[model samples]
Target chain A: MTAVLTTTAMPPAATAPTALRRALPLLAAPVAFFVAFFAVPMVVVLSSSLAAGGAPSLANYARVLLDQYHWDVLAVTFRIAALTTLAVTLLGYPLAYYLVRVVSSNALRRSCVILLLLPLFTSNIVRSFGWMILLGRNGLVNDTLVGIGLLERPVRFLGTEMGIVIGLVYILLPFIVLAVGNALATVDPTLEEASADLGASPFTTFWTVTFPLCLPGLIAGVIMVFTLAASAYVTPALLSGGKITVFPMLIFQQYSTVFDVHYGGALSITLLVFTLVLVALAGRIGNGGGDRS
Target chain B: MIARVVLRIVAWAVMAYLILPLVVIVGASLTATSYLAFPPQGLTLAWYGRMLADTSYVAAFGTSTALALAATAGAVLLALPAALAIARHDFPGKRTLLSLLMSPLVLPHVVLGAALLQYCAALGLMRSFAALLVGHVVIVTPFVLRSVLPQLTPEQRALEEASADLGAGPFETFLLVVLPQIRGGLTSGAIFAFISSWINVELSIFNTTAELTTIPVKLFNYVQYTIDPVIAAVSSITIAVAAVTIVLLDLTVGLHVLSNRR
Candidate 1:
């Protein structure tokens, strides 16, 4: 398949000099675009964060580090993100596995894929607004809980961590399913079959053979979910009912209301560094898992 | 058999979880009640009518549509050339450059928004449409790059070479041969970029004024203080737009991404 595809209409292999020359012009547009907009804006933020009172200072970082409010918000953000990631992986992996390994009908699988993607394509406000209605006092969720005798009164879901978690999980689940499903689809069934033929139980065959192959996808999906959930602003803001505060909310307030660019830049940099560190750590784990496989 | 039944049940439940919020928003928007309600109190389209009557909502919608369209166009222009370079050539810092372009996908929009606000303020561009456009373009360009790059295979490169060898200039070859092959990727990428820009609140929130706002940002502001059918109406419109876009996407590019992999 690879060889046939490669030969179909392959581009002439240009000489080194010509390839470099042709590529240089093409690179100019995107390179200049990113440098002007992305890289420059980020540099601006970092510089502002580092400079205070006309000199570089640790005051901004010190403010972020020394403040209990910042720590509390960061903790809440990380806790919600971790929980969301765990829930998505726990729920997504089974659905992905069932779709890939169990489902026989192509039509059904296709429909399932569409259903998974629908939420992803929808606006965050629209999705969170739906939850707002459902989690409201007269919302279906509260009504259902009451109807089922689970609660005597409608619990306040709009202003709680649980509400944010539900919203985050809804938005992030599709990433996990798609990632895991792609991995599951590519696993060599022969490997699992051989394990079974060697007198291993079905469960044992899955654990010993199938799961290892899909670990990289699982890790990638988890990392994506965690990073996104941690950085999420709209969902948390909309669902939190002004009672819950997260890191992004602080950044928004600084920029939008306070106009404290120096402080805001520091907060933004803090979140960026934290998210990047976690992403790097997750990549390391994914790479380690891939090596073992 | 038990395991199969359990798996089916779980899959169905997950699907319901995905659809529930959208259904609720649409239902609430049609409610005759002034306040938002679920099983909606006496179905009516008054909220939608009210939404139309509000000029701010209308203006916000117009601004969002224009912004998203402009951003998506800019992204396509920037990304197409970049994808060609990355796919067809090797260069120093190529991997780093690609990562820098794509990092916006995972970078917190609040941070980007704050950065842009600070940067633009220094340049006397803050809180203007231009400021919003530049930031939106920065974030959405990566989506276009990602979708277009994978479609530019060596095979496609060969076709472009063939076009060039047939006395076609680079621009002519790109238009006649290269563009048609990657049309699917471009269209899908543009759709994704457009929607991402349209639904954006974190990035748009910084630069948006009371007079200049996107729908999502407007909704976010209103949603904090009030829960009403008008908000529901606005949310419902966005939901409908999303449904339409997804259907169009499904028709054009086939949204079923994972089913045929095996």
Candidate 2:
């Protein structure tokens, strides 16, 4: 996830107000800039998606929603993203826990952090290229598996969904690790110690106390990963070897080659709406779970 | 404990997975053979020399660097004052405005890129450097705002007020007091912004022409057609830049990730 689940958005809170008269000037440039470049572009996309032949119509969306091929593309994209999210969370949680709580040596921890970040800081093109090479027929992954007798021969991975999932997981794993590690670091050890002192088993204490407390971060990380995985273009484009198509690729094609702004606008808005609704639903679920705990 | 041992093993394995691709890329870049090879048949830097000889690669690198620098500088300039306004004062539509600023963080870049391509085309600036820079600035601004907002604590409000009481102008107070304290956050934020712009493809893809392509996009088109030692050399260079940037960030701002904040 080059577009990552960073500590980007903090929860808004109500604070004491001292609104200055100069606040308007401070806010003017940013508001205008965001409106002109960010907000207006989005609006234009929405309008284009809604229009057909110079009138506002649902024809573009009808083409997207009424088609089986489009549905298949959506299914493949979401399936890969879901699998990537599941794999990333499972693999990343342990590393986060180990780095945060287990490693006492500062030098080793720092080195590990650097290693984790190396891929994050690199471009998706380079990273997906690494996978393209490694997942090739004679590449390291296939070579190791065959050498170890786990496989009889090299398998086709480059054009397959498995390769895409593997690449997506690798790209997204660091986000989960960083997110969960941040959450784990902030947990009060005394609470866990108190639970153990009160005769709780380690497993019981972790399930009852620690996990719930970190659920919000876990959920946030999960949302970030899923959205990014769902909307990913570059990795799937490269790793899929043109044998697979994701939602974003469809959008890319419409705008880049087809020159169909109406159709591309519909696809863009469709992806945007789905992603936002999913995030809001996940946020609601996370909050409800937190309240119950 | 056995549990601890297993966790350590898993952690080390994951770390290895993270490093393996990078090692492969760097290793493959040096293969004396014409094709890519790991544990390279023999070490040579001929690919690096070849890549350097290609002026297109040189030009792309320059373009990417200049674009990232301009985008980052623009983000910091735009975001700092907004962060100050949001953190230091209360106003109407503040929450709405804040969400708008942060929306790009979650919004898919492909969608944004498509929108920009369409929008900029209407404005007759399609596929220009300005189009790419605006999109980059829009996306990177949120990062700087997020990082800097946390640094503008309420306790600093008193310091700022005292500066104002001493007849220090608003710009002077910002320079001497506000800037000094938030330097760490600003540095990390700017680094993140620069890297994000540097590495972006989905948005940059729409606005880039063959004459003004970024390094990532160049490597992208080249990689799709051929996987050669030269592409590996270019990728390795990007990885080296990343490693150097992270190390620099850690030394300067103390990345201090996964560490408890007391």
Q: lDDT of each prediction vs. the true structure?
A: 0.85, 0.89
Query: Tens digit of lDDT per residue, candidate 1, span B1-262?
Result: 6877888899889888988888888887888877777778898988888889999999999999999999999999889888877886665677898998899888988898888888888889989999999999999999899889989996887777677667776566767888899999999999999989998988998898999999999998888788888988888788778778888888998764666454
Instruction: Write out the backbone clash pairs for model 1.
Output: A10-B158, A11-B158
Clashing pairs in 2: A1-A171
What lDDT is obtained when candidate 1 is compared to the true structure? 0.85
Residue A68, candidate 2: alpha-carbon lDDT: 95
- The DockQ values of the predictions, listed in order, are 0.51, 0.57
Interface RMS deviation of candidate 1: 4.7
Q: Best candidate per lDDT, number?
A: 2
In model 2, the Cα lDDT at residue A188 comes to: 98
Over 4 Å off, model 1: A1-20, A188-199
Could you give candidate 2's per-residue lDDT for residues A1-293 as a string of tens digits? 11111111112443333253435667888999999999999999999999999999999999999999988998898889889999999899999989988888888888889999999999999999999889999999999999999999999999999999999998899999998999989899899999999999887988899889889789989999999999999999999989999999999999999999999999999888887887788789888998998
**TM-scores vs. true structure, each candidate:** 0.94, 0.96
